[model samples]
Target: MEKKRILITGAAGFLGSHLCDRFLAEGMYVIGMDNLITGDLKNIEHLRSSEYFEFIHHDITKYVDISGTLDFILHFASPASPIDYLKIPIQTLKVGALGTHNLLGLAKDKEARILVASTSEVYGDPLVHPQTEEYYGNVSPVGPRGVYDEAKRFMESITMAYHRFHGVDTRIARIFNTYGPRMRLNDGRVIPAFIGQALRGEDLTVFGDGSQTRSFCFVNDQIEGIYKLLMSTYHEPVNIGNPTEISIKDFAEEIIKLTGTDQKIVYKPLPTDDPLQRRPDITKAREVLEWEPKTSRTEGMKITYDYFKNLPEAELYKKEHRDFRSHTKG
Candidate 1:
């Protein structure tokens, strides 16, 4: 079979880089595009040697130029974190709306199947315990986190619009808390934040009594589910995440144990609009795509720690990230 040509936007971020690696390993030609706003070249620098991997510095909100018939499109580009999106709210909005629209246009031109990376966040501090794709989210459009939440919601609407109106092949994966290698040390996501702090022997911070729950799926499992969904027949938003629910506090303590850090726990004020609870109902995923998360949080953290631990001494971003964790062990 002839190899497929796939274009991935936000191809430099944690998940994007991993997707590129997966595709290239399968002998596919991969084109990676990123603006480097929240992504770093170091994450994907190793892939430069692959003859099938190509990287371009371009913003998705701006016009994207490409040639040849693309077989797949993964629009993973967006400011995903609260801190990052809060810092650059407009960019997040533009990427979700304008950026996604442009890519749908490209998909039309190339006659390619496209997957827009949606999130559990679209469910907002969900009223439903284990969020399913059919559950309409309880989100606040005027909340502090509105920029990202609303942007993602808009992306879903437009993606469906393209699918229904233009007959564009589309897939939407409502991704949950995914953590593993290549995650930015200071991206402010919980897993990396805890690991960085524990590694540096600093206090770990848990917000709002540390009772907020989340389900974590390792990066490899996430990539696998994503690849399968793209090739499968499921089209509506599918929840892709582990079903094991752990509170933020318990998760922090586990990281401390894994890292062998005797760091104390510190109580920090929770961020505005922080989701009270989040877990994915992967029942549909298992039934339709025959997909279930294979990596445990403990095993995933160990692997992730090994990668960050291998970083050079001069990589002080990890060092500075220690400041975020408090000493409270709870």
Candidate 2:
């Protein structure tokens, strides 16, 4: 039997690298592409030896060309972290808009199914609690976070247009907070930020009195939900995340305990437009894909902490987590 060929953009980032591994294990020929803007090649370095995997050093915001048959395309390219998007807002917007448009065109050309990675940020400090797919969201297009939120919103709109007008097969995953190995230690996300502080014996920084809550899904569980969504026939957006919610203050405490650090919790002003609550109503995902997160926070955190704990000394101290020397595309 011939292997199914799939192309995954942002192929060197945390989630994209994992997806590449999953499809290859299923006997698919995987072509991995990334601009390395926020993605680290080190995450996908292990796949280099695999005969079924090929890495393309290219930015998806430009013309995307994949030779031969592409059975599927997973559009995972984007600068996901606030630190990243804030620093490079134009690139973030371009990837979500232009990059998505190009890939949707490719999917149309190939007659292949495409799944674009969307985010819970579409909810935009959501007016609705435990956001559902039906909520239209309360996003501000001009806010600082608006660059990313609106970009993803635009991505979703364009995706559905392509699906409806162009007859291209499409799926959108409204991914929530997910954490695990290969995450940049210095990324502005709460998980890595807290873990990095704990590891360095610094106080955990809590924004906005720490009353804000977020739901975190383990990476393995997240990838499972995404894969199931891609294979399913659903055409609408599906939430892929653990609905279990935790307050930032309490989550900071959890990290201190897990890292065996005696660090204190320090409070800071919340960034503009930061969401106060983020939890997915996964009723659609449960019904459509029959998927729910299976990894417990305790089990998942330990595994994640150990991964960060064992990192080389230099990695722990680097102000910037990404190293782009080798993978930068001219």
Candidate 3:
């Protein structure tokens, strides 16, 4: 019997690298694609020796060409961190819009199931609490973060259009905040930022009085939910995340405790359009995909801390800036 084949974009990034591992573990041939714009090759370096894995150094916003039977395509490309998208907003927009279009077209030609990685940001300082699939988001298209929010919103719109019009098999995973190993220590998300600061013996910076809340899902559980959604027969979007919510202030305290650091919490003004609350209502996922996150924050954070703590001393103090000039296009 021939093994299944999968193409995962952003394959060198945190979640994409993990997805590659998961698919290969299922005995599938995997093609990992990335442009190294925001993705680090180090994340996928360990898989280089596996015959089942192959890495492509290409950006997905341009055309995508894959050989032979492509059974599945998980579109995980794009700069997910706020620090990244804020710097390369245009590139972020292109990957979510043009990149998604190209992949959907490829899926159409190859007759493969495609799962596009959407995000909880689509909720956009959501008016609805515990965001449900039915709530139309309160996004500001012209805001600073709108580059990412609108891009994903457009990605979802076009994905559904393809599904309804061209009969392409599609799955949209509206992923919430997820963290674990291989996460860049300076991605500007709360979890890694707090952990990184704790590791560096610096004060944990809490924005907006540290009152805004975010629920985090462990990477393993996030990957499981995504895998289940891709295999299921459902066509619409599904919320995949842990509903365990925490405030920034409290979460900062937890991080300090986890790292055994005596760092104090410092407050700063929150960024514009930052969501005051975020929690996914996974009723659809539970009912349809039979999925719910199993890892507790305590368990997941310890594993993540261990991973980061073991990194080279230089990584702990690394800045968040990157040069996107080589990858950016006009």
Q: What's the CA error at residue 74 for candidate 2, in Å?
A: 0.2
Q: lDDT per residue, candidate 3, 83-110, as tens digits?
A: 9998898999999999999999999999
TM-score versus the correct structure, for each prediction:
0.95, 0.97, 0.99
Compute the lDDT for candidate 2. Answer: 0.93
Error of 2 at 63 (Å): 0.6
Candidate 1, 11-84: lDDT as tens digits: 99999999999999878999999988877788799999988889999988878778877999999999787768
| Cα-based RMSD of candidate 3 | 0.8
Question: Model 3 residue 57 lDDT?
Answer: 95
Prediction 1 TM-score vs. true = 0.95
Per-residue lDDT, model 2, residue 173, is: 98
Candidate order (TM-score):
3, 2, 1
Number of clashing residue pairs, candidate 2? 0
Error of 2 at 194 (Å): 0.6
Listed per candidate, the RMSD to the true structure in angstroms reads 5.3, 2.2, 0.8
For model 2 the local lDDT of residue 121 reads 97
